[model samples]
Target: MIKTQQLVKNFVSYKKKPGIMGSIESLWKREAVTKNAVERFDLEIPSGQIVGLLGPNGAGKTTLMKMFTGIIVPSSGEVEVLGHKPFDRDKDFRRKIALVMGQKSQLWWDIPAMDSLHLIKAYYEISDADFKERVELMAELLNVEELLHIHVRRLSLGERMKLELMASLLHKPEILFLDEPTIGLDLIAQDAIRDFIKSYHAKYKPTVILTSHYMQDVQALCSRLVLIMGGKKSFDGPIGEFERLLGSDKIVSFNFSSEPSRDFFNAFQPKWSDNGLQVEIAISKEELCPFCAKVLEQFEVSDFQTEKLPIERIMKELMMRPELLNDR
Candidate 1:
């Protein structure tokens, strides 16, 4: 479990004036500017839940993660993870939490991945039997048994990522922090990582906090979502509620063998494909059945299917107009 109240992290930087004369003047009289990377943020996460933290660049998601993990101390406010203050860096607290950041590498490049995992095992003081069993189980689950003995620098990003996950989870931490776990991975690799995480969570039931730019990652793994914007909490609720922020209209796309008349499709506010043979329409929930029936009857509909409101589109809209949350 994790909890934070009025959690704030401010970064201070010196404002450097342009030109040599300004630089000379700034040595004695530099202005200190403070910016709130995360301000007055509050959150509570129960054990055994997968929560997705979402925000755009410079939106303070990482700042919060760092604070939660005690990688950086907060400027003010209180944060507790598993009944211990993270900033205290207590041994038990560190043992109970694991953080995996995709943009950063924790393994030594010069050593084989298994070697690095062994170092981790020693640092965590894991028993030999437990360490060997965890390595075998996770490598088999991630399908990376062969790559474990290879030098880390020689491994591909996907392979390295799998090994990094194995190293992080060997301790069986009570809470897991995944910062873009599938980032920079190809489609197949991304799916593999997601599936592995799902399987691991089902068995161990660790509390997971995931942050990713990919909405599909969030959709696949998280039932709850917390949206951060401008260093503030804008939305925190069920994933389904986030999807419906743009309204309950159903998105349905139709692929036609031939183009349909503009007049027939114009009433539906259809967005046409570049080739004009495909179109997507947004239909109200009440009219969805009748509209699909009518379109099927009237058009040469080779294929058609309905989908939920896309989370990507919703995120785009929310980024442009964060005030929409007030209206909701």
Candidate 2:
């Protein structure tokens, strides 16, 4: 469980002049400007939910995660995680949460991953038997049992990320904060991580907050999405409802034995592929059934498929039109 009421974080930076004289003048007359990294952000996350935090650069997603994990204190407002104020950094609260950043590593570069894991075991005060069991389970789930003994620096990026996740989850924290856990990983590696997250959540039911630029990661793991812009909450709802904001448009594709006559699809404005055997068209939700009937009657279709608009396009539309937030 987590809650935030008008959570805000402001960063202050001073402006400096170029020349030495101007710099000396700046020493006494320095200009300090405050930038709001998070502004009046309110959020509520229930236990056993995988929520995706999405936004563009400078959107304050990372800042919010830091506040949740007790890594940074909020400038104003309130934040509570598992019934404890995160800013207090209580020992028990720290034990209930973990933060993993893809760009950063907790494993010792020159030592084996198991070595770092052993340190974690002692830090968390986990029993030796429990620690061994947790490590075995994590290794089995991630399929990285062999890499545990290899030094972190020698492991590939994907291998390092897997070990990072194992290290984070070994203590079975009640809340997990993941910021770009799959960044820079290939398709196979990404899928493996996604599957592991899904399985772990289903089994343990820990509340998970994930921020990722890759749409696939969000699609695969998150049921609800919180979209933020300019350090403010833009939209918060299920992924399906977010897509519906764009419209009721659906893409329909048809494959035929051969190319149809130009006049056959002129009225529909279908986009044909280079091979000329396939055509694609966009139709509204209301017209889908009727259009399919017409196409079935007019052409000898070998195969047909329909798909909703991609999340990427829907996100782009939301970014362009911030007013949609009021519609929520």
Candidate 3:
């Protein structure tokens, strides 16, 4: 449903010196610099898939989304969404897509969320009956039926976000673009939003491109990930493959009934803490079962578990050493 080839966007901005003297010199002699926000990026997304777009701040994830939505035209290259060039901003193209930014509100602050939803329905020319049906379904899915009459200004951030999501999906767009959909929300609210997104996708199968700093959001909603760093594609694959990219090592954390001697852990070189009562060991994937058995046999174990490396740690590695992606 979406395709791009060597897509690039360059942003030109001026740098000025500090102070009045610098301001005076900036009028005609300002220094201009061009930053490549997206460089030689290529991606293909098929229908009925949710792809997570992930990167650090200033890594161009947002810039790429803007290009896809036609909010800003790319400096060069090609982009097509649902068989129409996004840069053209065709009526049919706009009708088939929706973009939601957590930091920005589409709802009218002084008016009720229901009023804003009605305006969206009218703008999209959805039939009254269809609009009502869609709103009721979304409200139920998001548990926001009571908030619909609340003014946007009075609603909590989470409440307003639910309304924003409802507004975006009312048209039943073929594709949805979510940029930080759960930013600044509490854990409960975040889970609610994630569940709603999952349920909606299950029912509608709309192609979704989600960009969020919250690893939980990506983990809960996306099976595929497209990771970028410095405006270049770093990794693109299934989420499991991305996890394996970090390597075959797993972390084993355990709590013993009592503090173990340093000699007891000498063979494994475990990292111990909490007065040596808690220990964490890193072992190869191949040795996980055998090592677990050894630990259980040798120690009076109270609690034990194995975990893969966290996604946040892998992301840090990717951002610092993007060349690792070249092998992929």
Question: TM-scores, in order shown?
Answer: 0.95, 0.88, 0.94
Clashing pairs in 1: none
- What candidate 2 gets wrong by more than 4 Å, as runs, is 17-26, 253-281, 296-305, 321-328
Tens digit of per-residue lDDT, candidate 3, span 283-314:
78788898789878988899998764367667
Tell me how far the alpha carbon of residue 23 in candidate 1 is from the true structure, in angstroms, after superposition: 3.6
**CA lDDT, candidate 3, residue 90:** 86
- lDDT for each candidate structure: 0.91, 0.89, 0.90
Evaluated with TM-score, which candidate comes out highest? 1
Instruction: Point out the higher-scoring one by lDDT: 1 or 3.
Output: 1
Predicted candidate 2 versus true structure: per-residue lDDT over 157-267, tens digit per residue: 999999999999989999999999999999999999999999999999999999999989999989999988999988899988776766657778899886776566666
Model 2 is weakest, by summed lDDT over 10 consecutive residues, at: 260-269
Off by over 4 Å in 1: 19-22
Cα deviation of 268 in candidate 1 (Å)?
A: 3.7
In candidate 1, position 52 carries an lDDT of: 96
- Which regions of candidate 3 are displaced past 4 Å? 261-269, 320-328
Tell me model 3's lDDT, rounded to 2 decimals. 0.90
RMSD of 2: 3.1
